[model samples]
Target: MTRYLYKELHLAASPISWWFLAGALMTLLPGYPILVGSFFICFGVFQSFQHARESNDVLYSVLLPVKKRDYVTAKYLYTVFMQMIGWVLCAVLTVLRMTALSGLMPYVGNALMNPSPLYLGFVLLIFTAFNVLFLGGFFRTAYKFGLPFLRFGIAALLLISIAEVLHHLPGLGFLNTTTGERLGLQFAILGGCALIYALCTLLSLRASQKRFEMLDL
Candidate 1:
């Protein structure tokens, strides 16, 4: 499984996918929807899946002396790996926004979402939607991805829009704070989002494996 995942990163993945991780830098922008970074990261993963489909990677993969389930495991692990890298980047940027750069005029006065724990929670939710909808949909045919990814794109956009506007709603304004206001609630939201992400991804992995196993390939 480890070796297959290594192959996924070094060989099966599209080269441009790594470049999309740079979207994490969007966290530095004031008054913009930084959660779009999460969308871009998922788009990057989609491209890798597209590449795999075009190259018949799944057909080739099954030819190897490995368990059918391991193929799904490798893909899920690789996607999680990429998501974590983007998450870490956002986390570091959030720390900067909360500490050294907190007082900057633009960030201080920004009315849009700040790089707060609430923001990270939304990021995780965006990732969760992608994994459950897009990745799970892929294995249903293992050959059709366009519709699955399109569904994920729409879902991610909705998540990003909601995240951007949540803080503007009455009584929930602390979500955009740069100083980590309501720190305990923010962490609680983040923890809950993390749990949702884990459970949904694991369930999606199991479903994908089952679908792949029944594939006639």
Candidate 2:
């Protein structure tokens, strides 16, 4: 947590980003694509980028006594911070769904993706898409983000759709199970996706820093 990043998050982050963090509460909804909650989280981060671009925050930040990579690192750190917050919200709701509310008809009858470790893994997958596709793409031009965010949105929606139908596939129904019947497999999926998220985010950060360094700004 560099002091620069601390300032960027606390002072420069858009109010819209904070508002959209509430999207994680969508996890409480049944009969809906709960994974869309993760999409909203990414969208909120995107809003932060959009706000930065509109306000020329990048140019302003570079003029400060900060290295180019420091600015990039700050953005990445803030993005990850928001994502971890969303993940925590989803995780807490998942526990409720698996325990106190496990037998609720609405949640139990959800034809959409149910709250589970597998669901959390899909959330991480969506965040990975945002990092690699959106953040990485934006840094390529620093000034262009519309196309990158469009790509991220499409990828996120596609992932949500895939996650929703996965439980319907033969032998994969346990992915939506509320019981501990396949606890080992569920945790394995979550662990694997968490690893991929960490690795890919770090790679994207490095790639973004390099790209930003080469920019004439």
TM-score of each: 0.96, 0.96
**Residue-level lDDT for 12 in candidate 1:** 85
Candidate 2: tens digits of C-alpha lDDT, residues 50-110: 8888888888788888787888898999999999999999999999988998888887778
Q: Candidate 1 — what's its lDDT?
A: 0.88
**Candidate 1 lDDT for residue 32:** 88
lDDT of 1 by residue, 1-217 (tens): 6798788988789988899999899999987888998899888888898887778788778778989878888899999999999999999998998899988998877878888888899999999999999999988988888898889999998998888778889998877765544877898999999999999999999999999899887
lDDT of each: 0.88, 0.90
In model 2, what lDDT does residue 28 have? 90
lDDT of 1 at 137: 95
Q: Ten residues in a row with the worst lDDT in model 2?
A: 1-10
